[model samples]
Target: MERRFEPPVDGRGAQSVSVPTRFGLATREADGDWRDYMEMLEGPPVKLRTSVVEEHPKTILTFNTSPDIGFDRSINAYRGCEHGCIYCFARPSHAYHDLSPGLDFETRLFAKPNAAQLLRATLAKAKYTPRPIAMGTNTDPYQPIESRYRITRSVLEVCLEARHPVTITTKSDRVLADLDLLTELAEHSLVAVAVSVTTFDPKLSGKLEPRAAAPAKRLAALGKLVEAGVPAHCSVAPVIPAITDEFMEEIVERAAALGVGSCGWIPLRLPHEVAPLFREWLSVHFPERGDKVMSIVRSIRGGRDNDPDFFTRMKPSGVWADLFRARFRLACKRAGLEKPNFELDCSQFRRPNVGGQLRLL
Candidate 1:
């Protein structure tokens, strides 16, 4: 018989600590039965620890033909994000590996230590045609663990050597550490970077994106990118209804002030397991307005928790969506920000010379 599962409760200080049985077998709660009695006899709840496992995949490049996005190929140096944003759409992907889309998505991480080597081999293929490769599309390439692993940096080095065009999207200030490589890529018209900023409220940001860099730090990184002549853009993404929608104008305005060339927004999406996870998050952080917020969201999503259609998912409709769009457009106009037109030069791509020798054509 198919097992039924209920939405899991948020842990005292963590988001969705226990795995829900919705995907498969029904299991007892972490604190149920004997554990519940023991907890009553003891004091606080048990802490969930994070674990990292290294994976050496046969290949590292992921290619897609989706119409919703611009790039055809992308790379993700990590499988799970440590930033722990409650609204992450990629969380559901973890379920395919028999992992929880809740706390397990954040605590149990995977790294590709041989990513650079694999990417180098892939790009050096004799029939490989050049196109701008994208990074951080599925999971953050520069998550906290990146500092120790430096896998993303290694991939960049490979791109730099090959004169390959690349685009990056990230919410961490950690990208700033690679400013030197970014600057070089800019000179060759081979790079574009988008920094995502959801809101300026530190408290709300902390609650929503527990481990991401602060709003100010992200803005500063954008500024630094622009100052270094890198094509920097701002992403005011996943605009939550009745929660962070109000900050649409402010985020765009701040990003423009930082010299961002373009800005875009994505409405909140709760696909599959994300719907329940997000609902639980809402109840915990915005109990007073959780229902009202979901109501507005549903109204815009055709009276449903989410819209999975590609075109509709990118373009939300409704009174609230119209208002937010108007505000965003006006702010962009006032701040002199325009849609990004700069494209990375694909014709300049060259395979890196192996063994310190020149390729004889």
Candidate 2:
């Protein structure tokens, strides 16, 4: 292994000071071995800057037959997320492109500018069948960069014009920007949204998911979506043991107070590269409970950092898992929250004309 010294970035979640082993590949230091002592004497390290590259994928829709996931078809507007969440399961994906799943996963981003066009073409196929297309399943569609690219918005426009059913999951207030479109789709029973809330503590939230919407803002967004008649739900995702797990009931109760009738929760999952990244975060932020947290996580994951088996992965078992599930269920029941079961109407789908125009009669 080789080491290179780069200036540390500020306001980011992962304290990825050292690069981890590359996945299935050997890595050599890109820069020369010796550092310039004169440069180190200059000043403190500079922050890591984010960069975006335009990716023109051949196809936009990714199909999965995994029995655990709810949807079979989904779309990712971007390849890398700017939110910099240390526990993001999608971090390992960056390795396929030879990028670091640590800092690089957040700082280096890829935007699919032609995603909406490809989606339209795919939906227009003669054999195509309409189902609720899930967005933000892999990476958040409304991450900070969405404000600039607007690719997610374009996709929603296409879905609306075709009267296609769609489901969205996000942690950003940016979703509110598309209220007009979502409201229209809601009227037709064609849309549902879930806002993920990890913790209400602003400090913990900032450390866990740097640059994403604050917890309060996310709750507010969920309230706004529900007020607009969209089938909005609260997602208490990745409930970390010895950390954010305590907030599960609080999140559910708050969402219920905001008129959100449905809720869901997922135990924290540390697949592949995410495990080390999360460990680094824990050491930096909560050193005292880091080991205890991992102990519980391993117990839930069958003595491993992760459980890759399809069904078992989704259904985390063990004492901690059972306890967490029980608490979440009791909280939801007390709050009068029901598990969301809003089925989007697919009968209204219509293939737009070749010129990307919808013929409304």
Candidate 3:
């Protein structure tokens, strides 16, 4: 007769700190291993992290009713980001899926493999109005996996086919890979690209943005984009006080040197889940300066970790914000990096009708 074995259980079954347990029948001991008789006793349940399959959104265009942004609509090719910036403002988005906004946010990523097909279908709609569609708003379109998925490239192809205007914002030098397509779009007045440079210092960049392209590579990409005749601009985002804020002048100067036509800077914002994550990161990377860094951040955030109000979120209030503005203005003045002059023309918009005028023709 066969015997059944029960799994060893810890203290509490439901509320126990450890995982679930099961039991198995003990068998005859053979070799020196005494546990072999237990067959396959249930010890601890192996946590299987499941990746949910999300339907490919048929319509690629998304409306942004929020007044905080300059554009009304945008598109993201991927869901979770692999960049793994501890201070990333988009981290909280993972909570919607019951996933940890920490390591899981970086590791378990999702890409919209059908983004190009959706873009084409959306653009082909007769009622679809053409506006400069923004890319890389929530997560970077050129993030690491973009190389394999090539979703961004496909989206660009759709925009090019429709002669639709596009404005891209990214921190990856991988944007250079789309140079030929971008140059073609530029000739038709259909494209603009902004490369975000948080800090020119490599060490600071290493901690703030773990998997992002090197700062030097971003600068080099800026130069390359400009040389390719694509309207290129520099954005120094989330400028932290007493830290990267000090490099404002140098960043502007270097941008101008790279032939970047325009430059902009935004004060640091540690909103939602980002504040604590950033604190943890700072504690690990710059333990000595962690407290000081949070103190300065609080000073700008009105003694809080974050300010969610639209006006205050992008550019914080108080002395720190004022100082940042003054320094940025002075630096831009000195570097001759005037405000971005690239204004996408909406007047030329035309939805190529099915049997009417073929745009490319």
Candidate 4:
């Protein structure tokens, strides 16, 4: 295998690794010894790689007309993620660009350096009406790269200037860097934030989401955002059944204690490529529980790896789903939390170009 490295950028090496995509079967020795040296030779290293690309998407604002999600429009400042969460559903999206949804989805990343400028141009159009624009709906806006690029911050600067309503969702404490801006936006009922957290187990967190902030740090971030006057809620999204479900109540209680008024949970959905990638990840890290975990997932998914129907996709079916719903609702009751108040005021929207032509109220 050939390898090359570029000079360090932002303290992280800009080295790239590329591998041809292929498939293989899962097998072990007759003695059930997984670590036997010869077993290693059966599957070759796929040479996972990375490459840095500067992107400029035509439109920074993505209008989603999907009935499944609550928000109608969203923006992603970056593509491909650095956090490396094994169960990330966004993984399959990379395949559209002829990129592997495995390592390439994390290591081979792209950053849109001009997203803020594009957003400003978009909002400046005369016919454009204002509404709450959602961020971090796909790739995180506050990922590690934000510290240096600050693309998300620049987008928020435009939103602030336009008096546009904005909602943010992220797993990084880096959002704290924009506290002053968020505070000002909140005053006009124009801003809210959601923090996605799966579990409080540090060990599982390290292996599952390799580069994300520690669970403790995320909880501390929740507290800090609340204290700083940001309307923050806790989101235990894509909760893997049988793995992190056991901690549902504890997560809710912790968020409530930290002054988070709302909490919600979603069962893990392995749409398309995520199912295989997550299975590979399971075999590598949690071999013993891999089968059981997938079994429960199938139970909730109605004997399939995924259910893509609009309303039912987010809320699964079968006895397992019932049990999860019962447990989640009971936990929310005990923690004194309610379904999050996600509504934002859309009437306060202002288009910079229309102000001079005044109208009689």
Q: Which structure among the candidates has the greatest lDDT?
A: 2
Clashes of 2: 0
What is the model-wide C-alpha lDDT for candidate 1?
0.81
Local error of candidate 3 at 340, Å? 2.3
Give the count of colliding residue pairs in each prediction: 0, 0, 8, 2
lDDT (tens digit, per residue) of candidate 4 on 253-356: 99999999799887898877778667666765677999999999999887889988887788788888899899989999998888888566777766543233
Which runs in model 1 stand beyond 4 Å of their true positions?
1-14, 18-22, 25-48, 354-361
Stretches off by above 4 angstroms in model 3 are: 1-55, 352-360
Backbone clashes in model 1, listed as residue pairs: none
Q: What lDDT score is found at residue 75 in candidate 3?
A: 90
Highest TM-score scorer: 2
Q: Which is superior by TM-score, 1 or 4?
A: 1
lDDT of 1 by residue, 245-331 (tens): 888898888888877899988889888878877877877778899999999889889889999998688777899889888888898
Candidate 4 wrongly placed segments (more than 4 Å): 1-50, 352-361
Q: Would you list the rank order by lDDT, best first?
A: 2, 1, 4, 3
141, model 1: CA deviation in Å? 0.9
Q: Per-prediction TM-score, please? A: 0.89, 0.92, 0.82, 0.84
Per-candidate Cα RMSD to the true structure, in Å, reads 5.4, 5.2, 11.9, 8.6
Residues 3-73 of candidate 3: C-alpha lDDT, one tens digit per residue: 23223211111111111112221222111111111123323333323242445766777897877788899
Ranking by TM-score: 2, 1, 4, 3
